[model samples]
Target: MEYGYYPGCSLIGSAHRLNSTTKKIFKRFGHDLKEIPDWHCCGAFEYGNKNELTDFSKSNLKKAHGFCNDIVAPCPACYKNLKEANQDDGGSFSILHPLDVFEYFDIVESIDIKHDLEGRLFTPYYGCVLLRPKETAIKNKDIMENFITRFGGDVDGEKVKDRCCGGNQFFINRWATEKLSRLIIDNTHGDLVVFCPLCHMALKTFSENRKVIYFNDLLLYVMGETDKL
Candidate 1:
């Protein structure tokens, strides 16, 4: 089952670790990610106009659709934008988040756990783009819980799980982003597992002595692929 992949610009730039770790962890799960050729930005949160965003998202979707009907977007912004594009175009294809892949194919149980993180609490943060606007959200919001429990971890299940991390305003207003990040930090406890690169940056920049790790990197850590994360 080969799926077209869109790594988005962030993954290759500041979030390079996410790109490498996503590939490494997914390969370990016996799946493959064929990156979309001539891929462009999904417009991300840059252009909010409905028409502008649709065009930006559709460009990548069309390219990936040439490769496969099911496209996997590792970045949350890419996932949301791609999902919205598919919907606007008569729902012609599938847009799957990386976490969605783990659950949809039912692959989590198949991976052997190399280490048990007993009593280590983990907070699953979806940020704004990943699970808002219900129509574009992932099918199973609770899908991440299984991995944590199975891998021997505690989940905080914070009510602010879907709160906005103010990524859209990061450049325009640093104070606003910090305020949002502080709100999330005040509500949730334990290490953070974020799917979006911007969320990681927002939380890491404002958090005090807290581990804000990318979801893929955390998977790599629990799998014993690295000596220290």
Candidate 2:
């Protein structure tokens, strides 16, 4: 299936790893992540200028509809914005997070046997944007846990799953944000597997021992894309 792929500002900029790895995994599974033409940023959580986030998202949503009804957003913030646009603008389209796309397509059955995670710990860190407000959250909230179990990783991320990572406030007061992020990180000694790049950044910035990784990077490791993993 060729779905409209929207790479929000973070993905194209600091979160490129998530974008690249997400596209690679989908491509490996034979699903096309067709980027929507002339797509604008999701505008993150900033608002006030209703037109900036809403109008821009609706604009992208319209173009994505022209591409296809199914839209794949790697970033949770982008997914929420796009989904909101579809609903608020009366567009008939399914906005799916990459994790939802994984559930939609049985890529696990298609790929060859890959290296197992071998009991590695994957903290399914949702941060904040992925599963809040109920409206934009994906249908399968257990997706991260399910995927981790599918690859032999232990489910140890729940302790800090719902904890806030101080988000963009990390830049405002570095010490306080670090305190918040460290509390979340210190709870789990294993790597933090997150869907949002902002979450990834917050946890990683203060983490000392534990490696923070995007869900897509974990997929790449088990898929043999790189031996480094």
| Candidate 1 lowest-lDDT run of ten | 107-116
- The 0-to-1 C-alpha lDDT of every candidate, in the order given, reads 0.83, 0.81
Clashing pairs in 2: none
List ranges where model 2 is wrong by over 4 Å.
none
Could you tell me every candidate's TM-score relative to the true structure? 0.94, 0.93
TM-score of 2: 0.93
Highest lDDT: give the candidate number. 1
* Poorly placed runs, candidate 1 (over 4 Å): none
lDDT by residue for model 2 over 1-229, one digit each (tens)?
A: 7877888888888998888898888888878888898998778777778677798898887777657888888887888888898889875998888887777775555546467787677788887777886988887778778877887879785767888898768778888889889888877767788888888888888888788888777777778886655
CA-only RMSD, every prediction? 1.5, 1.7
Q: How good is model 1 by TM-score?
A: 0.94
